[model samples]
Each structure stands twice: as structure tokens, then as C-alpha cells.
Target: MKQTIRLEQFERADIRSALAKMNRGIERESLRITSEGQLATTMHPAALGATLTHPLITTDYAEALMEFITPVSTSITTTLAQLRDVHRFTYQHIGDEYLWPLSMPCYLNATSDIRLAQFGKSHVGRMKTVYRQGLTHRYGAVMQTISGVHFNWSVSDELWPLLAAEEGRENNADYRSERYFGLIRNFKRWAWVIPYLFGASPVLCKSFLKHSSADLDFHELSSGMVYVPHSTSLRMSDLGYTNKEQAALKITYNSLDDYVDGLRRAVFTRSEQFADIGVQTGDKWQQLNANILQIENEFYSPIRPKRVADSGETPTQALERGGIQYIEVRALDVNPFSEVGITAEQMRFLDLFLLFCLFTESPELSIECQQATEKNVNKVVLRGREPGLTLMDEAGEYSVQERLAHLFAEMAKIADVLEAESSAYHRALQSFAPAISNPDATFSAKLLRMYEEASKIFQHVGMRFAVEYRDRLKNSGYEFYTEADFQKMAAQSLAEQAEIEAQDKGSFGDFLAAYFEQALDKKKRA
Candidate 1:
């Protein structure tokens, strides 16, 4: 079946006006560590509020690893402003600690040294910690500590019905869901471009390679810096967040139902490798379960179809109740060049690229095509800017520059269709063209140049940026939120967390039983 409407149809629909009204949110993750660049031993700052209930600040895998989330905003200005406010407030609260300014982590001693994020005595809170524990057991703690940015985006509500009509489909949940799946397929195909343009994690501390089995021909430089020549984002490569077991999952984006089904099975199916870790090591819980996935969130993908879950609902349940609310772009590396880890121009370009994906014809992805996508992504991640490098496509091999040139041409049409601040989109696209023509213009290449010129290691550079960013935040002041507002939210979040803990009436064992039973029942019905 024809999966997507033609580009000509999109022009006829005149989606330009509707495209200008899209909403976006950003989730940025960073490690809060000591001045000496060691992981912070102190607990999550009390002034930052309860990690369980705080709307903006939370811990990811490690207690020291902080995640800043921005509320949905219609404009990149508001989104970035809110993100800065969160950072400013956080810097003010964290004592003697600095936010790690790079996507790759700083110096680390051992896996045991990294403390797991602790939640209060509530079962749900404990469950969250246990899930992280599972991640640690499956993937080493070093991999979990590596942080990045996630851009959550959705088109305006009005655009969806119009898009559905263009495809000769009903303006309903299924139609919307299918169209989103189409967007996802195209995103996967073109996502390699992201790393080529914005990837910043080119080098790393030799300590990170301690637990890794990567056999790349790395050049060992002075001060323990190790890197592969022309590498873009080691953070997105096999050296970063990835799993061999997941490769076997072969999760399909052909339909929402298929995607959810694949996730459900992963969560339920037991892994013999993980069984060795055991569910519990004596009194302490080693992990939530021995399943391949402890929860739906465990399935790591570069992009995900997301819906905000209601209270007491799982992610899968939320998607079942309401189709995808937004698409989360996870391929972004933390742009070390920006104080805030992302730029307004980058967001503008992303909007244009996503719109292009939505309007472009997306073929249903097969297993072979999926492998091709992975190959292309790895090519970009490892050696993207290499001159004369070619990427595979159904049409056959094409040079990286040629493919990007073609994509930018399409994106230019998308930029024109977008009404507000369209020049930002054009400028962003224009900036990437040079990176294709001259690899040295790429962020990774530029970062390497900076490292070489400064004669300092990644850790020293990261610390300098961290201090600079902290000072900038101190002077700039909050943009979207005030000190009083932050204090009020912090207090409220603590009280809510307390209330949740107080309301937990059942034992952890009973909670586990009920949760698994419900999941199994849901699977049977599906």
C-alpha cells in the first residue's frame, strides 16, 4: 500500500501556515559532579525539590546525573528560555558541583563508585530506582551515565486533520497514528544527517574504555585523551548507549500496533543473561525483573512515539488510550558549543527537517531496510565527514555530500512553507552545507581542533565550559521563571512526593505481582 502522500500533494495542501503553529519541548540531561570532575557523592540537592515529583528537575540513572525538562512551548524562544531558567535555578542550588558540559562523561574511577539514584520509600519511587539498577546490570554504569538531549515535538492540532485528508483518510486516531508511523519511518531513514551536523562527542577519557570492548583504532593523545580520527559522536556509536539483545528485537515501525506489541513482548520476555544477575541479591533488590525490558521506556530507540501517561498508567497503556501525542527525537548529542546544550537555530532546523519528514513519501520499513538504516547511522556516527564516503539507499550508494545536498534542497521548500522566522531555518541549513563540503567545519571536527589548539584534555575543556556557563547563568538571571516561582514549585513537589509515599499501603512484593499480572492480562487482550 502507498504509505505517504507525494510532496506535490503537500504543496497543494498549503501546510505552510499550519506548520508555523507546532509545539515543542526539550529534555536535556547532564551529570552534576564535583569541581575535580568526579561524580558527585552528595544527594540530589534539596533546594532543587523532590526528584520524584519535580516537574523540571529529576535524576536519570545515577543520583549525580541530572535531567532538566521544559514544559511544552509553541516557540523555540520560550522553550530555550525555560531551559535556561531551569539551568540557572539548578546552578544556584547545587553547592560546589558543576554540570558536566559535554555529552560524554568526565573522569570516572569504577562502576561501583557511581551511586544509583535514590527515591523516597514509596513503591513507585523504588520501582524507578530498580529499573535503573536493571539498566546498570544489563549495560554498564558508564554507558548509563552518558547523557544527551531529547527534543519532543508535535505539529499543531489543526495540521493533523488536514494531513489526514490529503492522504484520503479519515481524521481519526488511527489515521493520526498511521501518519505518525510514517513520520517515524522517514525520520529513521534521514536521521544520519543529525549526527553529521550536530554531533559533538568526538573524544573521550580513556577511563570510559575500561568497561567497553570497542576495538576501534583509537589514537591515544597526551593527558589520557583517546579518539578515532574523523569520528562524529562516539556517544551514539556502539561505544555509547546500545544493546546487542535489542538488535534481535527488530521492532517494526510499520504500525502503532506492531510497535507496541514488540515492546510488550520485550517487557514480558525473560533474558537468560539477566537471569544470572538475579532479581534479588539477598535482602537488596538487584533489579525490578529478569525480563529483557523492565518497562516500555527500556526500549532504547533514536526516536519514540510518546503520549503523556495519566496517573497509574504505563507508557504502553497511555499510547493505547490516546495515540502518539508527540515524537521524541533522541539522536541529538549535547552541543557543547552552546551554553544551554542546544541552540534556537538548531531547534528551527529540526522543525524544518521534521516537517520535511512528515510531507515526504515514506516507504514501509522492512528488515533489510532497517539494517541499511543502522549502517547509514553508524557511518555518520563513526566517520561522517570523511571525504568521498558513501551511504547506501534503495536507489543505490550515494556520496554523503550529494545526499545531504538533496535533503537540504527539499528542506529549503519546507523552510519556505514555514511562516515565522523562516530565515532561521534557512540559516541552519546553510550552516550544515559547509560541513559537508569541508569536514573540518563539522562540530566534531571543530571540537577536535579546539582540543588540539587549547592543548588541554576533554575534562579540562568541559570544566572550563562548566564554570563559564555557571557564571553566565549567574549574571543573566532567569528568563521564563522567577526565583519565587521556583521555590513555590519546589515546596509543592516535596509535599506531593511525601503524599505519594504516605499513600503507599501495599508491600513491594504485592505491587510487583499486581503490575506484572496487569501487564500479562493486557497482553492477552491485545
Candidate 2:
């Protein structure tokens, strides 16, 4: 039923060098809130450069929803340092606005207040905006405003050959892609562990649920605060990032080809629900198209196989050209306790856990198994701290604690291998053991406990953390970038946006048509 790689079979030098050299990057998202804790109505900060071309700072679904990206790095400490530099630089320009510390947005009086992120007049820029509009027409803007952290990572290139040789397979692109897919499948099987450990959004502002009748059992602390008593991340729950429509697509990870085809089909497939809204309503481009997804980016999942797409190349196209170059983990909630939303230890833990995913036995997921995985994730998202809660696996039902114990036991060997580079790997792995026996020791449980003891409303607590982090980031010096460096990057991004606008040709309609005309076949046509 499974095939696990024995750590003893690999040479210690190979283990030490390969695992130590893995690449990591972070995309941290935060909503800009006023000093009064209301969402900011300002456009993207000019000093942060064009959202379309900025290398580090940009906006997400809403202009106020700021996203800071770090360059790839081989060291966890260096990656965190880069992220810190970005945050400090951003704080310098945001003027009085605070980066909301939590994953969920601050209270919003109306959905109309959430503005779609804007780019310049270029065809590519317009397409980006139109696609977001499509999301709004499909799902509400409030849903898009909820922010989280994305961890982009890739195993060392050297490690793949070692793994290939161990498995008696050729060390080629196909082999690499196949192994990465195996990692993805295994990641899916144990994905619930992520939210259970790092989730911080147990309580939500009462206004978040004002417009809809979501079927959830929430305890109201006051008129302003509502939460699930034993919940971990409400952000990952049905009330937050979960999508009912996308669930029907059933994208599988049996192979790179199947995964690519599934994404392409979702992009091309028409949706009657989206069609009812119409693509163009009264000259305003309501959406890009009436497809189930405007592009591959719209298919939300806990994790994704990724590649750095060249200009004019779609995600699927890039995968077809070179297979998966990396993976992006999307399940982490922004840790409110940390100034930069994540810690170096958290990064180390992720590296160890992902390696465990790669080396473990991953079975092909049938549709039934996929649904079971979803159920397992949902259970953890809603009631992760519930005592004695059981979850489904290939080997029938098991206690969540039992499953975690097994996972950590397997990961200990990876930590040992990685310890050759730094003892911190083992330390990070060992840090979560306390949470296994005591749910209150977990981040979500601690966050909720802190909130309850503070005797303040949920939004008030969030605002306090926002202000605290803002002040700290403003005062703390940059870790990796200087003020001059950020200034030059901003100027360069502005120039790039202008050049892109100047080089544009044809109407946006023609550009959109040509974009959709790209073939989904294996090789690109000349």
C-alpha cells in the first residue's frame, strides 16, 4: 500500500549536503488597517512601486491587502532576514496604516469597501484586474480579503538523483516530477497537521459573517466576537478559504501530465453559474470569461506544484515545458504572535516535514480517497483541539494524536540527517511534541487563550497586535536591505511598468482572445 525510502540506504554525505541546500521563499500577506482598526481605502502605496512589477512588495485581491515576497534563499535565517527587510521597508511608506497581524481581515462595514488591486494600462495589467473581477463575481470580495502566508520551497537538485538511484529509476526530468508528485500526494494525506499546529484564527469579527448564513456553531463572546471553542483556523474552514464549486473538479496528483490536464480542463470548462453573471455587463468587463476558473491560479488548494513561468507562459504551460520546479504551501495562517508573521523555527519545521513527505510512501489517491482527505482536513480546520478526535487514513480510522505521533517519529530520522548542517533542525522538530499531548500548547489554542484572558473584543485584540508589530517593524533596523536598495527597486519596478505599457499592442479584447487561444498540448506549437 506504500513505499517508503530507507534513510540508511542513502550516504550520510548525500543526506547532509542535499537536505541542507533546499531553497525557501516566503509570501506574507497582510491587510492594511487604519489606526482606528478599520480597513484602509488608500490605493497601493506609490513608494512600494507598481503592483504589476514590484519584485518584493505588492497587493493581493484588495489594494489594502499587502503582500511581501522574499527572494529564494538556501538558509532559513537568510530568508527570514529578507522578509524582515521587506516588512521594515513597507512600514516606512505605509504612513499610519498598520499591517493587520491576523489571517482574517479586520471588520468591514460593507463588501463594496474592498477594492480590487489595480495595475497600469498594459494588456497584461488589465488581464490581472479582470481575472480578479471574475473572482469577485464568482465569490464575494470579503472572501478574497482574508490573507495568509504562502511558503515556496524546492528540494535540492542533487537530492533527486540520490533518490532516483535508490528507487532504481533514471535521474531525469520525468523522474524528478514523479517524485515531486509523490510528495504532493503524501502532503495531502497529512495536510491537516499544518492547520492544527500553526492555525491562529479561531475567533472572527462578528461582521465577517453578517451577510451570509454559514452553518457553523459559534460561541458569541460579545456582539462583536464569535468563535468556535475548539477550532484552530477558521480561515481554512468552510467560512474562510474553502470553495464549494472548485471541489467538483477533482484534480489528482497521480502524475505531472494528469495534474496539468486537470488544471487546463478547469480553465477551459464553462460554468453556468458564472455564465449567468456574464463576462461583459454594460461595457464593464465583469469577468475574463464564463469558465470555472479564469486561469489556473483560481483553483485554490492547500498546496500546488509550481514553476517560474516565463512572460506569456501560463502555469500549466511552464509545467509542460519543464515539469514542477518547486512547490507552494498555502495552508499556513499568518502567525499573529510574530512580528513578520512567521518564525525561523517554523521555517525549519516546514523543511523537515516536507522532506518526510518526499521520502514517505504515497499511494495514488482515488476519488474516494480524495474526498476522505478533504473530510480529514475539514475536521482539523473546525475542531482540531477536540480531545480524542479521530481521522481517516488508508489504514482505516486513527486518532489525530496517534497519526501525529507516527508522522513525527518518521520525521525524526530526517531531522537527524539534516542535523549535519544545523542542530536547529532537530530542535524545530522536537518543539511541537508538547502540543501533541496538550492541545492548549498549540498556537491556535494559545492565541485563543490570550484573547480570552485579555477581556477585550476580538477586533481590539487584533488591532493591538497590529499596532505592536507596526511599531516594532518601524523601530527595528532592516536585516538584509538598506533604504537605498528598496528605493532603487521601487524606481526600477516603476520603470518596468512604464516600458510594458509603452510596448503594448492591440486592443485588450484581442489580447484576451489570443491568450485563450494558446494550445494545451504537450509541446508548444511554432
Candidate 1 local accuracy as lDDT? 0.85
lDDT of each: 0.85, 0.85
TM-scores for all predictions: 0.96, 0.97
Q: For candidate 2, what is the TM-score?
A: 0.97
- Evaluate residue 263 in candidate 1 and report its C-alpha lDDT on the 0 to 100 scale: 87
Which regions in candidate 1 have their CA more than 4 angstroms from the true location? 1-14, 456-459, 521-526
lDDT of 2 by residue, 95-204 (tens): 88888999988889898889999998999999989898988878888888888999999988888887777778888777878888988998999899999999999988
For model 1, residues 16-116, the per-residue Cα lDDT tens digits are 57768889999999999788987787889899899999999999999999999999989888999999999999988898799998999988888887889
On lDDT, the leading prediction is: 2
What's the number of clashes in each of the models? 0, 0
